[model samples]
Target chain A: MNPNVPDDSAAASRYAIEAVAEITHVSRRLIVVYCQHGLISPVATPEESGWLFDEEAIHRLRHIEHLRTEYGMNMAGVRMMLEMLGELEQLREEVRFRRGG
Target chain B: MPAAFKDYYTTLGLSKSATEVEIKKSFRKLARKYHPDVAKDKKTAEEKFKEINEANEVLSDPVKRKKYDELGANWQDGGGYRPPPGGRAGAGHRADGTPAQEFHFEGTGFSDFFEQFFGGAGRRNYGFPSGEQEFTADGGAGRARRGADIEGDILVTLEEAMLGTMRPISMQTADPRSGKAETHSFTVRIPAGATDGRRIRVPGKGAEGTGGGVAGDLYLRVRLAAHPDFRPRGADLYYDLDLAPWEAVLGEQVIVPGLSGAIKVRIPPGTASGQQLRVRAQGLPIGKSGDRGDLYVVSNIQIPTEMTDAERELWEKLKVASSFDPRSDSKT
Candidate 1:
């Protein structure tokens, strides 16, 4: 739970696509689709066999699932919305930086 | 249990006769404005968004709208309305004849009022089967099933977010046998650099699994509480630095409040109001990066509310001597 507390790089958990799908409740096909569409990238470079995802990828996939199932958005719309949300977050950071928050 | 009457039209700022298009328009506007993802005040925005969604759910559907209007009309006449036996509320079936079922919103927040009135219908519309198997394993019929995952919001302060902290959380889970709620309390360790909307998972701490199955995980959704001196956006922080006009013009080293403590910041000469100064690596920590974002200090030039005679004389002399005109280029 405290990934940074021990400062052990090897202690951080990494998941394959199957494990990511299980944890996030998203299908493997959809996860592959997301990666193919450049929505999310693997934490480490893919070997000849498989790709490994970090915890951030799991969170992002969960968010995408929420947008799709709960909000009833299409994949294209979800992708656009996620990009916009990222931009909006960066813009908010800039605004807060300017305000000296 | 009966729910209090809800005025959906008033919730959406619409009239009784509002059309479907009008309802859609209002719902979209409110949804975008208060979506928890984009809102600065997340807690309030989340509440508002739930209320708006519930309002939209009833108003946007023609059959539900008709029944709601009838109920509203009756309530208007009686000054208080109770559902008639075997009527809309008593007959637990939707307008489409689907049997009423308990709907669980999970992390998607809903209200008791919504549960009472339109919960079953919403489940049908959303295609969520009531009492659906949450996490099923492919074991034999007698095998235990994993417990359902539980989610709740936890409020954290700016300082606690920067440094790792522990929080006590009280959770209520329904007893499977008796159908009664049982409350349990425990402490959770939140890691440093936890940001707003971040989800922290505690393994095997959720509801007890049936038949000796493993317990589900508890997910705590982090919400950062408002700080008096700091405004946080992502990992960056902002603070307002107030200076007198003379100080702003003359430029001097000043003490400004920071998340940790007061830090000395140099104000360059001829500093203008609304100017921002950056202090790199002084903001909140990012997730496990071990590197901090920058802090921004905005300058606010202040004039004296009231001046002593001596100060007024000095100001008058300076005013006469100074040739600066802020409005010099403005056309009348």
Candidate 2:
């Protein structure tokens, strides 16, 4: 579990790759592909047994899926879009901060 | 529900005679302007983008354009136009005469107006998942379909964001079969370190799946409420630290409001107006790392506007004694 997250039982739950696939509607193969592509960084289990994902990972997978399926974007395009969106979000936050919001 | 007539051309700021190229050009320009991702005013931009996309969807397509043109002046006559029975708009029904399988646009950002007219056609052409599998009446095997995800905004205060909080949310969606609106309520646990635009997903809380498919998830996009006393920058909080001239010259310890409570911050000696003081680890929580960002207190040196005669005399004496020239370096 990520130490930064509160110790509440609900937020503390971590999922293996398979459970992540099940909940996120992503196939196990695609999950591995995402991991390999460095789109996501799931924690490695003890002795590298498997990967563990937190809730944030699940949210990211869903976002990736939305971009892929709805926008008809390839992984490279999705990656680029995500990067741009991140930058855009950062810029927006900066604007908000400057505006004293 | 009564269908409201929408004038696609007007919505796109185009005329009925606009060329295909003109339509595309106008759409791209308007889309870029109003796209929620880039727009400065996100809420308004989102609504505008949805409207622009809906208009473009119809006008950009030759078939839909032709059908819309058929409506002609009636399209603008609110309640004057009733689509003829068995018209192309109603062509989504299967030949077997069962009402067309319902598709929800919960997370799609399309409106009921778009769904009423072009939803089925758009789905068939766009190949968006219908969220439910179609099966024969006899219970034969069918493809498993995923449910449609729902997206909405949730407002959180700065204090609530510092420490995790639970929010009760309620949403109303129309039942596909009966067309009756249904309300569903659930509590969402917002994690600490949540920031503006952060999305939290609640599994199986979205539109119900058809044919025994699983329900979709609900995604709540976080929007921070405006704070009166502080401004948040990423993980840090910024607050104005007012100081008297004497305090600015002579360092003083003062208490200020923090995310949790009052915190004593030191105003270093010789601090100037607009200078910032950082209090380490006094900011909002970062992701579950047990680490925190620092808080920045911006100094605002306040001068007395109305002074007593004695105070004015003292100020005059100080002004005469002090040789500091703020404008000495100015070229003008």
Candidate 3:
């Protein structure tokens, strides 16, 4: 689950990946890959079989889509780029900590 | 149409059973090349893009591609494209040529070559395992239903509208089964020339089809909020060109704000109130040419509500010397 998305208290507000795929044009495989690759995680934990996704996943999937269609980057490429960007920020943070700024 | 095997492998520039990495890389390469912005030539780019998307649709899915590959030799020499006994000349018409049903691409152009080769029987009876049984009617009343179109709006500031900015708009969509309102957000790329009344259509983002029909679209109507200083017409912007009485008569180059940044407005000598000065190509964007409308500066002469003694003396002297008269031919 993304920390940025506020939690919905409504019991019926939740959904699974299969349902999310219908809303967004993202395939189930790609949605799974996003979770595995840490692009986006589900807001809720699954009780029995499949994982449950929330509205936040839909929002994040749209971001991933822009990177694909508009930017023309594939899922794997998007994952790698996002990882590198996160690393760069961490490195910047370390430097700042060292300088005590 | 014949059951010609559309080689998904060759379509993505891959062998029959290429690795996942190879397929993804190939798709990325093709997508960049055929992207609408990069490919300015619309007709060619659109054809290539559709081909790529069609290829990806099949190739990206393991099950579909596997099923397609299983029919191997059957598809090699156009095997599965057999028409049901008799051929219908026009699309969706019966073998008796009685016009069974009409097909619509809805004015959006598709490649004629593609339509010629793949448009016939292959598309009509694609009995995918998931939804095949739903439309198993022999001939009548079992057609798949298309989804309803969805509508949405995006709110932007006047400045954002003038220069154009991409904004992420959030929406609440109902879950099909649960009937829950799920919040979703997508960033829309706003064109530079977009105005308050302008609308953008994003295909395939609207409602899902009921049966197996094509999905509807999402229409984003742009709404621009008011600005403190600036107002816009179609492409041009309006601002009050406030000038001192002396500056209005003598004319001066005054700094003013434009869409990009500040610009100097050159007021000509002897300019009067309500006089409009045009600065070419300084307003909002005109279509794809990257040109814009002219900025119009309407002059307003300001009078001193309070004056210093020296200012009053100067005004008196000017009034005595000047031949210009107020109410000269008046009956007041």
Q: Which candidate is the best by lDDT?
A: 2
Top of the candidates by DockQ: 2
lDDT of each: 0.65, 0.68, 0.56
For residues B1-332, write the lDDT of model 1, one tens digit per residue.
23467888998999998987787778767876876655899999867776776677678767678977877766634344565766555323445554432222233234445544554322222112111343235432466655544444555667778887665554445543355655555566767787766666655555455567666555555656544357677787878788999889999998887777778999999999989899988898877779997788889998899989999999889889989888988955
Evaluation by lDDT, superior candidate among 1 and 2: 2
Native interface contact recovery, all models: 0.06, 0.09, 0.00
- In CAPRI terms, model 1 is classed as incorrect
What is the Cα root-mean-square deviation between model 1 and the actual structure? 11.6
Q: Which regions of candidate 3 fall more than 4 Å away from where they truly are?
A: A1-101, B1-144, B158-164, B175-178, B326-332
Clashing pairs in 1: A100-B238, A100-B239, A100-B296, A101-B237, A101-B238, A101-B239
What fraction of the native alpha-carbon contacts across the interface, defined at 8 angstroms, is recovered by model 2?
0.09
lDDT of candidate 3 over A1-101, digit per residue (tens) = 13223222211235678887886667898888888888988865555646787544554566577567656798788888767856974664343222211
Instruction: Please tell me how candidate 2 rates in CAPRI terms.
Output: incorrect
Q: Write the per-residue lDDT of candidate 2 for residues A1-101, one digit (tens) a residue.
A: 12232323334357888898888768988998988897877865535766888766777787788778766789999889878977987886675566442
